[model samples]
Target: MPGAVLAPTSAPGYPAHVRIHEVGPRDGLQNEPATLPPDVKAEFIHRLAAAGLTTIEATSFVHPRWVPQLADAEQVFPLVRDLTGVRLPVLVPNERGLERALAHGAREVAVFASATESFARANLNRTVDESLTMFTPVVARSLDAGVPVRGYLSMCFGDPWEGDVPVTQVVRVARRLSDLGCAELSLGDTIGVATPGRVAELLNALAAAGIPADRLAVHFHDTYGQALANTLTALRHGVTTVDASAGGLGGCPYAKSATGNLATEDLLWMLNGLGISTGVDLERLVATSLWLARRLGRPSPSRTVRALSHQEPRE
Candidate 1:
């Protein structure tokens, strides 16, 4: 119940435009125990684009041994890369992953590391420094090829193994990523343990570290149902980009007690109600989430989709 207060109505020099990056195809589906066929993932990407999501994380190019569900990344990447009016970014763990992504016509790639030392070792099987070092060549190669690289800093909040993460550590990791030429850095509340105050404090620290708000994005999970409130905190601190998943279909495999991500449907609803324009079709988006949930053999986890579907249709 912390941060129950609404975010401030205004902050000095907050960006006018907000961007929502769709991560359902990659982060959402990848952690699911069941494997979704490449074609299904491709179709889901297509539908998300049709619903007006311009930026979507299509798949990860990691070795199949690590994420078996995304083993068909090679096939899925090519299918979504050519989708008109959408940027499909693939996650790359190292240079080898980047090479595979580039082979599939990847124009943008993401390199991820964790903020908490324990989570870094558990998730990437490397220490914080080691994980960043492993992706140095990957970032250099992407820069050489003129491909945009986004850095993901996971466990920005508390970690399962290492309880509350230090803001100083988060700041250090994020500063390193920015110094590495990552076009943008995403701060992830990997297990959704953030309070609005914590989110605000983190953003303030990053700003103090000389990382501009324009180069920052937030990825929040809804494990404790605080994602939306935490998001408002990010907005107050001038974070203009967010990462959300359709139907709330994602949870981190490495982080126990984590729940689905901040749902795209839920995010859209809140944004629209706040008079923030996202250029998305809400009804179409709801239908799409329902369709995907059915395909995955589970009910949609998007509370907004469920409520809106039952209410009197909006004009």
Candidate 2:
């Protein structure tokens, strides 16, 4: 069941254009215990570009001690720096992170804030307001430097420390980020506790807060195997962009038992089956996933990839 081929596409109400922002390089590998070489990271990005993923979150510019896996970000970014038609965005925790990212010639930057108070405190070591205050300068600096910034709002579904995050809180943080000059705000189901109903409710509130669905992206983890379902719900609500990991290699360090982000191969498989124009190559994506999986010494978590690779031979 983990690697089953999806059924064929049918006519649906979904949009024809959906943007998939590949997160395997940064979010997917940050939590991994073993350190991968800079060249390996570059090869992974190369394969991703080959797969037709137009936008990729290349790395995070956090302190080396906090995430040693991404310590080589400064070193790794310049290797793939000249990729045309692909936006390589890096995550920045503060002004210092932004400075480092700009030094590496990053044209886009992403800053993260959480909806749940507990998660905000644990992930950023500060309160929600404090995190926003910290990002204000980062956002302003990026804007001043002509860099586009994307905001990530985590824990929209539920929190490990606090269950069932309030919709009001989600809206508040999203609005604050939007007000802080973030070009886009991605709502994250960090713990994968969201259902379709909760997603609709949260989107409704965000809409009321003057944050359009077009400026929104959905980041769902497949912990409960509901990442695809949640993504479909967001698409129905007019969300055009999504954040997924290649080969399903992602997890939040702040949440216990949190699975990785939705796999890129799996998402592309689903989108291809739905006849949606994601402009992604499923076969190349699967190959890249396999390569990364071998480097990590773990089997790929993408069900579709596993299925396609293990298809039975017809005699």
Candidate 3:
């Protein structure tokens, strides 16, 4: 969104490829006020796959009681489960959530952990240690069943109740989750207060703690308009995986100040400029977001989506 509306330009210090873990169907939709039907939700997943997003977080099996917006996880998962070359990972809160996703043919699952104790109690209703303990068996069992487990460490950069989370505190929880057998860990800036320097510091601390860049992903929110900047810093630190939401839809249900995630289209525009290979079609992705926006009765919050939507097509 910061770049000019022109052809993608190549840059140095970036890899030839970056993996975008699209979270619109799960993290994005879960925070929305509308309760979309399962069939429509399934179509959204299919459209994202068609747009070339290989890893799409389909839905959460965290029970209908907690997140009524994604209440139809059982119905939504099956609609696009067989999409070829696409991996759909569902969010599993505990062992029961894992089984529910497994029953729906989930090949990958993610467990949520909080870097700070305050957020841990707020989001998971457990302390930092207690949440990790709850996730230990979930990660173990998922691995035993040949399903890769991803660890989502929220409030990595900042938290609402706990001001300015220490880098050391994040690394401590991150190390424990990684040790618990999480194949990948997504660091979340839950309140969108992360700046470029802070993002670099956290990545550096994690590396110092023995967490390789390859096993780490960054999930950023755009509340302060720093998502792209923070993400660029992570990229320079060799973080290859990024979590984004289509149409800029998502917010923390626990943290009221938290806003939408890094828009998938906005991230793609920057990555494409850097000559990174995501295998995602930007036009298709923008179109997908537009389609979803119409259903939600609002315009997409993504700057790229809005710009490209109104741009003149070339001959």
Candidate 4:
């Protein structure tokens, strides 16, 4: 994009290399209205890896009743199982989902929890504590099988039903996940209502509570166009892992107020300018997103994609 803002040299507290945990294949596509064929989904994932995404969330083992789009997890997993040099993690809501993922040879998996009561009910159909209880065994068994678990705590900032979630509430849920054998916790701005100050406050709280910055990741939605700003704040606080989607694809079907996850291309734009290395090739990444946009029959919501689409070739 022509208006790219370059990251200043020697920005304080920013990591040299940020690990981008690409969630496009799973979280990005799960909310789409049309279901992509298993093979297409597999190819999309392959392209993401080709664009230098090392950790790509492949699919979810969620029941079709909740997310019908990813019901073919069994079919999709095997198609991309043999891809070398990439870590493919699947979403496992409970023990059954974990079993399904294991049956297909998944090595890494993620469990999602909510930081707010209303989100816990709407998304998981259970209270916050109950949902965490449900994941206890799932996390335990997955770790026992030599698989690492990623815990996702959604609605960490603001909830659609309950506005302005307390920082303590988020820390409570995040701590539980960390203690439940989860190797890492991804705090999510599910509704994109988080600002930079709030992000700093939450991270400080987590740090003060003995949660190391390395064990946490940030997943932001662009509902209010603050994803990048919030992410900058997270980086300033020492978060090295970020969750993003190609083509800006995703929204919470359960939480209607939410929008797409932060676009991988947009994040790359800022990261690249700031001298942060993510190993992603920006041109290849944009091409991959554009290809996906064609499949979804819409233009990408990414500003970088739009800017590059209209730009003249550089000499």
Could you tell me the TM-score of candidate 2?
Answer: 0.95
Clashes of each: 0, 3, 0, 2
TM-score of every prediction relative to native: 0.93, 0.95, 0.96, 0.96
| Tens digit per residue, CA lDDT, model 4, 1-315 | 455555546656789999999998999999998788999899899988988999999999999999999999999999999999999999999999999999999999999999998989999999999999999999999999999999999999999888999999999999999999899999999999999999999999999998988999999999989999999999988899999998788989899989999999999988988889999988878888887777888888888888786644221
Over 4 Å off in model 2, which ranges? 1-10, 311-315
Every candidate's lDDT = 0.87, 0.89, 0.91, 0.91
Query: Per-residue CA lDDT of candidate 1, range 65-133, in tens?
Result: 988999999888777787888888999999899998898799999998998889888889899999999
Shift of residue 147 alpha carbon in model 3, Å: 0.6
Better-scoring candidate (lDDT), 2 or 3: 3
Misplaced by over 4 Å in model 4 are 1-10, 311-315
Ranking by TM-score: 3, 4, 2, 1
> Considering summed lDDT, which 10 consecutive residues are worst modelled in model 2?
306-315
Error of 3 at 263 (Å): 0.5
- How far off is residue 144 in model 1, in Å? 0.1
Deviation from native of the Cα of residue 205 in model 2, angstroms: 1.3
